[model samples]
Target: MKYEKALLLVLAVTMTIITELDLLPQIHRMGFYCGDPKLSHDYIGDTVTARYLLLISFFIPFLILIDKNLYQSSFSTYLLMYITFIIGYCLCISSVNFFKILFGEPRPHFFDTCKPVEALKCTPGSYVSTFTCTNSDLRRARDSTKSFPSGHSALSTFSAGFVLLYISNKASDWKRIVQVLCIAWILSCTVTRIFDHRHHWWDVLSGIVYGMGLAVITLR
Candidate 1:
């Protein structure tokens, strides 16, 4: 348990820095430089949605730990609460960062800092911006390469799908409805990433797919 908390905290901070400093620049060279037009930055504003969602999501695993029924009743449920969550979150986050570095998809917020021309291309090593950063010496503003799949989208759906699986097995219809609504909330949380100008539709889509895939794999 102690190791888990330590590992989770380290990973969380690492992901935050990676998204901020390394990914932002790549996003700047793409089109529109913002999220989809429908949600816009108006009703679906970026800062408000992102801050709340990202912050609140940190507690999900903690809450799972508090729920006695989640693990004590079944072996599979215990695995879902512990092993799957650790592996799923680790894999999804690491994969997103790895692919972002490999794929280099520009973020929607790139327009805020730089001008993105038509069909812009960033040379692999030579970026429009040059910077040096190591793991220990991470700069939040230096996240210039992290816009492949949405981590928040992945995390939310991952937990939601876990809850969905548990709820589906329960005998209560009202509880089932509540679980369904929770799923919708998770989906809306994914949508909020686009509204926040942090990810594109495709990024969110990939995240949703990753999360659902984990849900199914972990369940079976």
Candidate 2:
């Protein structure tokens, strides 16, 4: 195995162990302060909203970079980056959703919208009828149900991080500056999630760590 692959395996295994042991809570507290995260899902209807446009604009160039480097670039490292991103995409989505179903932690507007708590178990009836938020929030409880790890944070992190790695290897001058800026961008994305109150700090942190860990391990 490549030495990097060996390091990747160790990192993944260590992460699994750490999370299972619930060590993060002891390490990091909540956040700056508990802010109300409830945002109107209404803006989603307006595709031109700042949130929508900002996110799309940020990701588009990153996608271009990934494409440029992925199958098109000559570097063998790029191939590994490509394969790992495809796999990480699946894993991130699946793992977040799976945990959401398992936990069913209330959404941000849970108090305002949720029906009186049921047995807190995922029964067929609960799935169909139990709790709901107003608006499309009610329409997609499944998406809101699992807030432990922020998927948006994970995705953005992965994209930025992979590109950062590519740039780190490819750039000639100001490599350190590029990487620092990328890490700052990652922090900004994670903070945005908390600022919007879409997720708790813990959730974003998980995504940050998961995104970086996977990128470093899987792509290196």
Candidate 3:
């Protein structure tokens, strides 16, 4: 069993790395324009690194405390469960990244990144071509095309949903409160992506479904 888990972890990590590498250039492709430049500009939300750190900090203690109170499980058991959660998260993220690259849908703030010169002459709702980004940040320009699915929403939901599933399985008086909080957090994260002009409603909806689906499969 240990060997099997180790092999699974290795495979998940390998696939995630390959997906990340493929994302670089794949995200640079042209995507469907869906928003006006004037209204779409918004500050980028929390960084991915920060979000992951926050979720880890929340989960580690929460899981450990739950295990101690409910099952009196050994440290090694808790550790194994934690590692399993991490692997599940990696798989979920890898799958989402693959879809983002495959779809190549433009973000809400795509115009801010693309800065098409020809767009000046084009009427509102009309497509513009033969343009370049006003900003020299190629990375941001590339990311502008990876907006079909909201990564933030998917990741946030995965983390929250995982915890919710664990709580539901455990006998605890705080389960209801935790469940409500988890659902609220997931909704807020998904909504904020739209407010930040990072994704469309449909993108967020798709992400929610994807994340929840994977969480159910992984947790079970």
Write down the RMSD of candidate 2 (Cα, Å). 10.4
lDDT tens digits by residue: candidate 2, 42-116: 212211333542354245224434334333456575546555555554454445444545555544544333322
lDDT over C-alpha atoms for residue 18 of model 2: 55
TM-score of each: 0.58, 0.54, 0.79
Q: Please rank every candidate by TM-score, starting with the best.
A: 3, 1, 2
Candidate 2 least-lDDT 10 residues: 26-35
> Which digits, one per residue and each the tens of the lDDT, describe model 1 over residues 38-150?
21222223543545654555445444333445445766666546554555555555556666656655565443322233214544333333322232423322233356677
Residue 28 deviation, candidate 1, in Å? Answer: 14
lDDT of each residue in 1-220, candidate 3, tens digit only: 8898898889888887887666444733553333465335754754344356346524632543543543335777667766787788788878888888778776777777756555556666765433465658777766777786887778778878877776666677666666776777787778777777778889989988888788888867
Best by lDDT: 3
lDDT: the better of candidates 2 and 3? 3
User: What's the count of clashing pairs in each model shown?
Assistant: 18, 1, 0
RMSD of each: 7.7, 10.4, 3.4
Give candidate 1's error at residue 97 in angstroms: 1.9
